[model samples]
Target: LLETYCKASGQRINHEKSSIFFSEGCPQVRRDEVKQILNVHNESLSERYLGMPTDVGQSKMGTFKYLRDRVWEKVR
Candidate 1:
């Protein structure tokens, strides 16, 4: 089903780079993967960016440890 969505939409789905179905994390590799996802998706990673923007960082940002929290939110 997911494969079909990607194929029909002409979107390349990278499971490894995609955010976890539930949790978040921000390891070096995962960060890079997320960056790749954003770049491919042409997402903006800015604080003002609201809702689930293409930039996962903005969407996943947490209360403390802004940077790390954002990363983990996407990875975990």
Candidate 2:
């Protein structure tokens, strides 16, 4: 699917450099299947950008944790 998108959009995807961040409850078997299909490594929650979270679980708070802190900072 991604390969087709890349071809249509003229964008290149480096499988070796790509990483997939699955939700916390995602089954290991599913994760393994996706990793195998995409040829990208599975990323852990530790992998984040600009201090924001990388993993998005069933708890919405965990995904938007940075926003809560920012909102509190503004209120002060």
Candidate 3:
């Protein structure tokens, strides 16, 4: 389906750089199945996207730690 979409849209996707992120509490088996179906590796929920941390709902403090650190550094 993704390949078909890319071909129809004339957009090529770099699968090597692509990753699959699952919601919290997802079973490992299900995650593995999804990865196999999409041909992408399983990425940690803590991985950042566009400079902001992903899965912030899982750990608000951990996810925003980067921002807090930057703010502290600036204050110093």
| Model 2 per-residue lDDT at 29 | 96
Cα RMSD, model 2:
3.6
Q: Write the per-residue lDDT of candidate 3 for residues 1-76, one digit (tens) a residue.
A: 9989998999987778887777679999998888888888847554568888666676888878879999999999
Stretches of candidate 1 exceeding 4 Å from the true structure: 23-76
Question: Pick by TM-score: which candidate is best?
Answer: 3
Residue 74 local lDDT, model 2: 100
TM-scores, all candidates, are 0.27, 0.56, 0.58
The residue-by-residue lDDT of candidate 2 on 1-76, one tens digit each, is 8878998999998876667778779999999998898888846556566676665558987778779988999999
Can you tell me which runs of candidate 2 are displaced by over 4 Å? Answer: 50-76
Where is model 1 poorest over a 10-residue stretch in terms of lDDT? 40-49
Clashes of each: 8, 0, 0
**Tens digits of lDDT, candidate 1, 1-76:** 6668878999987744444321345565765676564544332244433434333545454533475667899998
